[model samples]
Target: MPILWLTVIVLALAALGYVIGRRRALASGDGRIRNLHSLPSYYGSYVAMMTGVPAISLMLLWLLAQPFWVNSAVLADLPVSAVADGSSSSLVMSDVRRLADGLDRAVAQGVMTEADIDAMGSDLSGIRTRLGNVGVALGSDVSTDILTSAQDYRTKAATGRLVMSILVLAVAIVGFGWAYQRTHKDFRARNVVERGIRYVLIAAACIAILTTIGIVLSLVFNAIAFFRVYPASDFFFSLTWSPSFGGGSELGILPLLWGTFYISIIALLVAVPIGLFSAIYLAEYAGPKVRGVAKPLLEVLAGIPTIVYGLFALLTVGPFLLGIFGPDGVGWMQAGTAVITAGLVMGIMLIPFVSSLSDDIINAVPQALRDGSYGLGATKSETIRQVILPAALPGIVGAILLAASRAIGETMIVVLGAGAAARLDLNPFEAMTTVTAKIVSQLTGDADFSSPEALVAFALGMTLFIVTLGLNVFALYIVRKYREQYE
Candidate 1:
């Protein structure tokens, strides 16, 4: 069955279970609500939870596990000769999956039948043509071994899905029957349902924690692999940034780091003052009507996609800056793409992150602080400078750090505005590239995954991750110190 249909059927069963359980609870109490241990609604919710949760959970687990199971089975049965020279098993498995999907599509499109597929043993003559008709283009002709494996994969996958559907429906039906039988007037349905909800919440929290752990581990492992092939000392300390895939490459991270920090510093210089002042105006001085109109207009910059910002930097800002700083003017800039271009655009992109967050933080300062300052004969400006700003300092620092992180991670603006020249030049008008832009460059096209060039992307990502993590830790320390002082 289609997953959508299965979900609908399961939901229908749960809804029916809810009505039946409620009625049964009322019947057990002789239709008197006061005689029941819990409310009639609690009994119905308990039944609905029992009917839906276990079955839905099983269905999700089955879906996640099915692909792995199918891939393993197909790979184990696949012949060694199927994988071409210089190619990995993963690539072969990818082709097998695509071919299997194509066969399924071919059947669905009425171009082929199950008997045709069964009879088509290792023949690549017409199979590719038929598959192409259904819009399934393969990189190369299908081999006999690949064809057989795909067939086996399709068969096992179909069988597994069938078994999963049967098992899910069975569990749902059993849960409904059991819950219906247990829905008595004295049953503690509320307690049971609440306990189940607590577990679900705990599971969600664990998933989030586990996901973070998984990301860190992946970066660590890939970076370790990269270090094994390339020298850690060169990667960390060398000032150049030249990556040649055909060996003898210089993989220095310093230039990239320099560019990243240089651009981010410029961005912070532009963003912090403007964003903070705007926040002050919005939160402290603006009238209600003005605040309502101006705040959203300022925040709308945040909603504009990074790509749009990148285009603005590339086409408009870069050219505008170049005209002033190029040969016709100061002659400091050689081209349109430069650090200043990306930094200014990125600063614009980060305005909302700082302004909106800082506005909220400034507003969160206690009104009593302002009144106390006023009572001390302080003017509004003096009171704001001393009391409101101080009270809101911790949150504002956090907001700035958050914006700094966003600046550090920005890629599109850097790619389009900052030319892909990794250098240690201090001039903001000169072209430069960041770690994120280089990460994208390193991983683009048909690069070999096991090669140092490709693996360096992970190393760059790990370095970026560490830098952002340190920023977060510093932000936390500052927040804690100020929070303790203020509270």
Candidate 2:
């Protein structure tokens, strides 16, 4: 059965169980609510939970495991000779899976029958034509061994699905039976249901933590693989960035790191003063009506997609800068796409990150601090600078760090405004690319995964992750130290 159909059946069973369990509890209590230890609804919910949760969990696990099991089985059955020269086993397997899916589509579209497919032999010319008729295109001609493996893959997958449907339905039915039997006037259904909910919540939290661990581990392992082929010292110390899949690629990260920091620092310079001043005005000086309108209007910048900001940089800011700095005037910039263009636009994109967070932090400072400063005959501006700003310093620093991280991680604006050239130049008018942009470039297209050129993306990502982590730690230390002093 299709997963959707299976899900519907399980949910229908759960709903039926809810109604039956509630009626059973009412019947056990002689149709009197007072005799029951818990609410009738709780008994119903308990039945539904048991009937649905286990079956759904099992179905999810089965779905997650099925592809790996099927892939392994089919690969085991496939002979080593099936793979063509200049192609990896993974590529052959990919073709096999595509062929299998194409065949399935052919059958579904009534282009072929099971008998017809079984009668088909090693010759794939006719098969390819039929597959194309059903809009399934293959990269190369299919082989006899590949065809056989694909058929096996399809058969196993269908069988797995059938078995999964049967087992899931069985589990749901068994749960319904058990929970129905347990439904009684004296049962503690509410407590059991609440405990189950708590466990589910705990599981959700664990899943989040495990996912973070999994991401870090993947980056670590891939980076290790990359460093095994390319020297880490070269990657870190060399002041050049060039990757060639052909061979002798310079995988230096220094230029990329320089561009990243250069752009980020420029963005911060543009954003911090404007954002902080706006935050101060909104939080401390603005009337209630002005605050209500201006704050939301300012925060609207945050809601705009980064890609849109990139486009604005590309079409608007870049041209404007070029007209001033290009041949028309100073002759400093050769093109519209330069570091300053991206940096200025990215800084604009980060304004809300700084202003919104800083505003909230500034507002969070105690009014008593301001009052005490004023009591000492300090002016409003003096109170803001000497009392409110100092009290809010830690949170403001945190907000700035968050903005810096945002600046570091930005891709689209950098890609659009700053050209894709990695160079260690001090001139802001020069084109440069950041680590995030280069990571995207390295991983894109038909690159060999095992090659250092391809795997270096992970190394770049790992470096970025470490830098962001360090920034966060520094922010946390500052927050904690000042937080204690303020307290």
Candidate 3:
């Protein structure tokens, strides 16, 4: 409830601040306001941050401290033995608090029965008696009153925060209104607001960076823990992935890598040509009408969920392929649910990803370059082939690597499409498992996290993260180099 109110208060304050700032700036009628540094929302956001952030922060701090403070005060009133030797300050504190809450609930519900009071007494006694046995299992041992009082205090604090937030917004509005009324030729309201807003934007950017860092840190810790158990050599080098459950788990990651690479290879082979052609058609051949209609339609491929692709691989493509080579006509293929089926489906899925990006890069190529080549009597195809593709090549490479990242991170499609076998087989027709496949399977139903089998997921996740990061970095390098060429 406090969190909800805080959000509401923040937004209201922000909106009020924005409106006030905007009106003040508009009324100023100065060339400075017209040429003002930043967006109107910045001032509003600034005021909102000012009103809400500190208040909410203080509220949170108060909420955290209030319980301990209240609990300590109540415990001080109780007998020394009631403190239960401080063996379970943490546990007995909760017990005392619950007992206090129990008393309050009895009053709230109009239950004046001896049983209610007895219940509260039992809560107190339970803590003192169970002091020696204090551990994780113990919950609380207080009266209904103290807990209810705590809840009521928390509510009051939240309400106080809301009132303060609203007051701040009102102050902003009144201040701006009063200032606007006194708007002489020398008024600098816009400057004041814009300055405030720029800082707010900086804060937002910092927040995004911090969040990214936090996520990376979490993944790093887990990866470190995983490497502690499983040797790095086995994860990267060993080419025979055979993770175990009950028996001795070989935990080879090679087969998974092999499957992932195999599927990705087939997808890239299918996508590159098709995607490149589609991009060329859109950028060079298609009319504005055709381009307009086809571009979004092509992007629909990207919009389709990977799970849909997996289902297609499973129910549709898997069986069709199996029928074609099920030890009958030519026996070249093993089963319908093989690497090719998944790869082919995944390729189709990646088409829009490649085409759309390539289209943008290709379209970005200087029209003057094409015109220069054409003025020399080169054909349209020759001009485009000679000029556009070469210019867009780096961007195209980056796009492909971006698609590759999507392919590697893809779990649902492979989990459904690729066979659940950990064999290092050469045949694409044979069932092959990937890193993601092993991760998914290893963590299912009765997972033992401490065990090597369960810990394997972390190692595999780290591998996936590292691989994707490398791919992105390489793509960034290519894109940067390409951008420099044009610039």
Candidate 4:
């Protein structure tokens, strides 16, 4: 909560700084003649970036480290007997927290004698107060060892944040000042800023690339460990997915993949036509008011929680299908808990996902193409069908691919909607399971990490990552080439 407030405060300050800086720049500028500095917006943007980014970065770092630091401090205070064995960080932290709170409660309840109660209360209170005091302190407290540790954590945190903030501000100021100083007849500060922006974009791309590499490497290493025990052949081609409980287990991808493909294909079949037509109608037929009202209404589909979709699948669709297909009745559909039910519900969920993107891509098709088609006596549908769609094809394909990726990775809908039995089956109405569902099943209450059953999840994860990455790459490639053609 504090971190969110800090971020909001920083952003607000940045916006205010931007507004003030822009106003100052404009007021000082000679409107009739050129001035010696940047445009008003640049100065404002400079201040805004400086004000927001560094503080946000500090907040992010603080968020990541807070639990670790708090746990370490609490652990240091614990009596050695509390965590004598070499326990994991999670276990140790849990015990220390339990002990501290228990001591406080015992004291409150008069379970402990007065002397013990006083000392325990003092220790807990001292630790809490020192942690608070250390947050904004500099250098070290120097009063005592525990106090010094607290202060050191605080000082380092504060100093790091100060440094980052200064760096970002210095950059913004330098950019603004340089742009302002060079604002003469021949000066092209616009070009300079654009070039700087290009670099900024490249940096953003690098960050994404680095993150992808990190994720891939993490999955690969763990997958290698999984393969050490389980044969790759069995995992890939074995038609059954009966995960071993204790002694011996079989880890197979075929069943999970079967379920994943079944659900996704069903989702796509439902999503594509409805989504495409909606996009067409939005882009070509709607008035401004209709478009505005309808677009948001479509997006409301996206905002509906996945859990809701899951419940609709389970409670409504599943039982309905079960009633028709459960042997006593005419079976058009086999069962509600089958791939079709989850897929149909999920497809409804993804309509807006596809529609919104398809709308953007369809709109991007050149008006010239439509004009040419009309000149050739093409009707409205003909122009859209023949020229506009083909022109927008690559981008449309990209949009569908993006939606496909979302469907493939979807967790909650499958967990609630799809049955948990992992097995290969061609029947969509039959109970089926997906990779994500399997992951959840494997990691539940009695998970044994050393066992093959638990470790196979890494292999499943690796396969999922590779598949999604390939889809995204293909989409990006198609979009890039199409974008070039339009350019």
Candidate 5:
């Protein structure tokens, strides 16, 4: 049976259990609703939980474990010499899986029978033609060893799935019967169901934490592997950025880091003041009608995809800047693709991020503070500058930091606007690339994963992670210090 059908069967059984459990609880109470300790609905929910949760959990575990068990079983039957020249055991296993699937499809199409496939043995051309007629392509001729392994792989996988379906259904049935038997007027169904829900919530939180840990660990391990081959000192301190697959590549991060921050600083300079001023005007100065109409228009920038921003940078912003500063005019900008273009476009992308958050934070400032400042004979501007801004400073700082992070991590705008030239130059008009752009370049297109060139992507990622983490920590420290002072 397919897993989908099995799921349906378990759900049906659980539904049946719910009905029975609800009726049994009411019957035990002599059909008097007040006689039950908990509600009849609670009893039904408890039975459903008991029937579905355990079976689903078991099925999930079996699904995760089945591949590993079957892969090992199939690998054991594979001959040592089955791995042909310039190929690996993994590659051969891939072929085996493909052939197994093709054979199954051929049988389903009535082009081949089970007995015929079993006896086909070393009939490479014949099998290929039959499989091809069904639209399954094979790269190489089928060998006796591979053919045998495919059959065994198919058999083992089918058997495992069958056993899994049976066990899951059995567990569901057992849970249903057990919970039904326990259904009574005195049974604490509500408590059991509530406890189960709490556990599920706890598990969800733990999964999130574990996922973060796993991502960090993966970065650390790959970075370690990279640094072992490439010098950590050079990788961290060198002012160059070049990667050659063969050897002797100057993989320096400083130039990339400089570009990344240069663009981000420009972005912050553009985004912070405008976003903050707009937020203040909307929050403190604008009339209700204007604010209502204006706030949504400002926030629409946030809803726009980063790719659209990239296209705007490429077609509109980049060309416009170049027209003003390029060789045809000021002779400062050489082409449309330059750091200034990326920075300006990225800043536009971050405006809504800064404005929306700052607006909320500024609005959260106490009305009492504003009134007190007014009572002190301060004008509206003075009150805003001294009272509202200071009160909302911590949250404003947080919003700025969040925008900075987005600016730093932006890839599309940089790729489209800033030309991919890793150089330690000072001119914003000059083209430069960022760490994110370099990471994409290093990993793209026919790159060998084992080489330092490819592995450097991980090291770059880890460096970016550290930089962002430090920024977050610094932001938290600032927020806390100021928050404490105000409190």
Candidate 6:
């Protein structure tokens, strides 16, 4: 049976259990209004939980475990000849699985009968042609050993599926009967259902936390693996950025870090003043009609994807900058793609991040501060500059840090606008690149993953994670320090 059909059957059983349990509880109340300890809905929910949760949990466990069992069985059954021409057992097993699936497809399409498949000799004659007729292509002719393994694989899989279907239905039915018998007027069905929900919520929270820890651990392990093979000193201190998959590559991060910081600095220089001023205007000076029209327009920039901004940098902004500073003009910039172009476009992309967040933060300032400044005969500008801004400083700083984090992590804009030239040049108009761009370049194509060239991507990722974590921590510290003053 298909997993989807099995899910439907389990849900149907749960629904039947719910109706029966609710009716049983109400009938036990003898039609009296206040005879039950908990509501009828609680009894229904308890039955549903009991009927669905165990069966679904069992199915999930079966699905997770079956693949390992099946793969182990097939691997053990295969002889030494199955792994031909330096191929690993894992790769050979993949071929076996594909061939098994193709045979099943052939059977489903009526191109072959089960009896015919069973009675076939070990020569495995015409198997490829028959499977091909059913739209399952093979890279080579079937080996006799592989054909035997695939047939065994299919048989074991069929038996497992049959067993799973029977077991899942049995558990669902048993859970239904158990919960139905326990449902009575005096049972604490509400408390039982509430406890189950609490455990579910706790599990969800733990899953999220565990996922973060898992990611951090994976990065740390891979980075350790990379450092074991490649010198950490060279990776951290060298100024060059070159990687050769063949061996002996100089995997320096200084050039990439330089480019990343230079572009992000340019982005911040463009975004901060403009975004802060816009926030000030929108929050303190704009009328209601103007605020309504302008706020959404400002936020629309955020919704426009970074990819679109990258394109704009590539096609529009890069060319425009080239016309101003390229060799054909003032001879300062060599091409359309340069650090300035990417930075300018990235700054534009981050403007909404700064402006939208700062606007809300400025608005969150207490009205009493503004009133006190006004009472002291201060002008509106003076009041805003002295009182309102001071109160919202922490939040504004937090917003700027967030925007900086966004700028540091941007890949597409840097790739498209900033030319892929990793250097520590002083000129903003010159082409440059970032760690993210280098990480992508190293891992892409037919690069060997075990090489330092590809593994360096993980180290770079860990660096990014650390940098952003520091920024967030600093932002939190600033917010916490001044939050009491504002409150």
Clashes of each: 0, 0, 24, 3, 0, 0
Local distance difference test, candidate 6: 0.90
Candidate 2 residue spans exceeding 4 A from truth: 84-86, 106-116, 119-123, 480-487
What residue runs in model 4 are displaced by over 4 Å at the alpha carbon?
1-213, 332-335
lDDT of each: 0.92, 0.92, 0.70, 0.72, 0.90, 0.90
In model 5, the runs with Cα more than 4 Å from the true position are: 74-78, 82-155, 477-487
Which prediction has more favorable lDDT, 2 or 3?
2
The estimated TM-scores of all candidates read 0.95, 0.95, 0.71, 0.68, 0.89, 0.87
How many residue pairs of model 1 clash at the backbone?
Answer: 0
lDDT of 6 by residue, 382-481 (tens): 9988889888988999999989988999999999999899898999998999989988898898665667988999999999889988998888787667
Instruction: Please name the candidate that would achieve the greatest TM-score relative to the true structure.
Output: 1
Which 10-residue window of candidate 5 scores lowest in summed lDDT? 478-487
lDDT of 1 at 236: 98
Worst 10-residue stretch by lDDT in candidate 4? 136-145
- Candidate 4 overall Cα lDDT vs. reference? 0.72
- lDDT per residue as tens, model 5, 48-122: 989998999899889989989888899988987687555567767888999999998999899999888777766
Q: What lDDT score is found at residue 33 in candidate 1? A: 97
Cα-based RMSD of candidate 5: 3.1
> How much lDDT does candidate 3 score?
0.70
Model 3, position 468, has a per-residue lDDT of: 92
Superior candidate under lDDT, 3 versus 5? 5
